[model samples]
Target: MIKKAPVGEIPFAIAGDSRIYVTAFVNGSDSLRFLVDTGASSIVLNTNSPKLKGLIHNGELADNLGTSGENSVEYSNDNSVKVGTIQYDKAGCAHIPYPPEYWDGVFGLNGLAAFNIEINYDDFKIYCYPKETLTVEDSYVSLPFTYKYDVPFVHLHIKLNGTLHNLLLEVDTGSDRIIDLNTPFVNKNNLLETKKPFAISRIASSDGGSGELKNVFFDEVIVGPYIMPKVAGAFSTLIFGMQSKENIDGMIGNNFLKRFNMLIDFNADKLYLQPNNFYYTPFYDFLVR
Candidate 1:
């Protein structure tokens, strides 16, 4: 017999750039705003975060690679972390460099692995159900994914230069832009030759790095059963320097995902996409906003 799982609902607020944030209590003391980042592997706390007060530091060190470069970070263990009615004891966390204004930390997939998390972008709420008891609706399109270094990767078919190319993309909810391509994929496919001159723009990386990216209109981008036509993407070398065991082709960010109400089950290796009311909404250049 399968065990029944508990259900929890947490309210989330949208940042100016459309990033989702939730307030979580650390060690039953300080409450901090943590970005709900699916792209991140582990829970990351800013070194300057006030919530770091009572956590015990562990001697393990890790390197976090971003658009700028790599930063060496340390790990810590907290007695308990409370998110809504759910509590995790002896939670492992990464202590990284100071985050930007209005952001204290990142709540990643490792922190939410026990539950099947549903991100209701339309309602600004997060519904979490125990993985065993969670039931996916028939309207949802289930996409298969593989986890590497605690990050989720999915295969997407995108039409570039009238040829359909299968690309492996990271589902990055923490990113504001629609699509960010890596250098190898861009060079191998000769994407620059077909770029739109008028749509080129400079983009700022999340780690305070900056690079040039050109927007290209694709004939179609198919994610699971959904088809997005005339999709816009930013081709850049921003992620070329990042260290990864897998050869990642690019990333799929919030601008492309916001149109759907998503459910990500990391433990089960499944992503469910249900098109919301804004499914057909026009895509804007959020990087410039």
Candidate 2:
């Protein structure tokens, strides 16, 4: 018997800094992290990495425009990627012969659209809402914020070291990981140690310049009373676009959002997040204003 997926919940996972995590198998191997990127038209390597062999190939190169509007060349292969129990037949991706410098392969929207997914950036969690029942509370609510606009991100709060450190965080659905910081924010907080370095790769700026990749451990990241332990983040030194003028420490991306059920009510000046488990408090209310 063919069984249908449960309702209200989407099948998805996230990994890396703030990227969506997809459990995909390469060449009948175990599932691994496939970063979800909506902005990318196709997938490519950071520079030069062995993972290139994992991508299925049919001998075709494609031209791509990067985030900074630079032309990127790639090759697509016909490979089947398995996520969860569902297998995508004829799955194809752009193959980079070598990762640029410090880059990793991403599973962009073309790969993710195969499944129905909804993510709440504010809660640092994404709910696999049951397809059978759709809740009405998913609508937007205005939170008490100094800003006059009723934007979705204005209400999320940032917590540092497991404590509310009075830092501002922007919830970006477009981002793949939980938290990604700009150079200024990292420097202002003195968060990085020059002697220590970690290797990570992603899509670089249009100019083909290196994107800063650093490992970070926050004692805790708290938003609306939700706490994530041993969280990792990125510190980007490259100024790809206009510097983040929002003065935010970083962005809250899907890496964290895929963990729980969230309710955002902007009109009430509060955001609610309910944990999947009972040991923790179900409701987390935040006062943005």
Q: For each candidate, what TM-score against the reference?
A: 0.86, 0.44
Candidate 2 overall lDDT versus native? 0.45
How many clashing residue pairs are found in candidate 1?
Answer: 0
97-179 in candidate 2: lDDT tens per residue?
33333334565545444433444443333333222322344333323323211122444444444444655544443455456
- List lDDT for all candidates, in order: 0.72, 0.45
Which tens-of-lDDT digit does each residue in 1-289 have in candidate 1?
Answer: 0124337777888666767889887765677888888777777777666666545355488766664355667777654677777788888787765644646778877777768788888877777777753456666787788875457888889987789989888888877778777777887778787777447766554344566777877788987777888888877755434322238777888878888888887667878888886687667645247
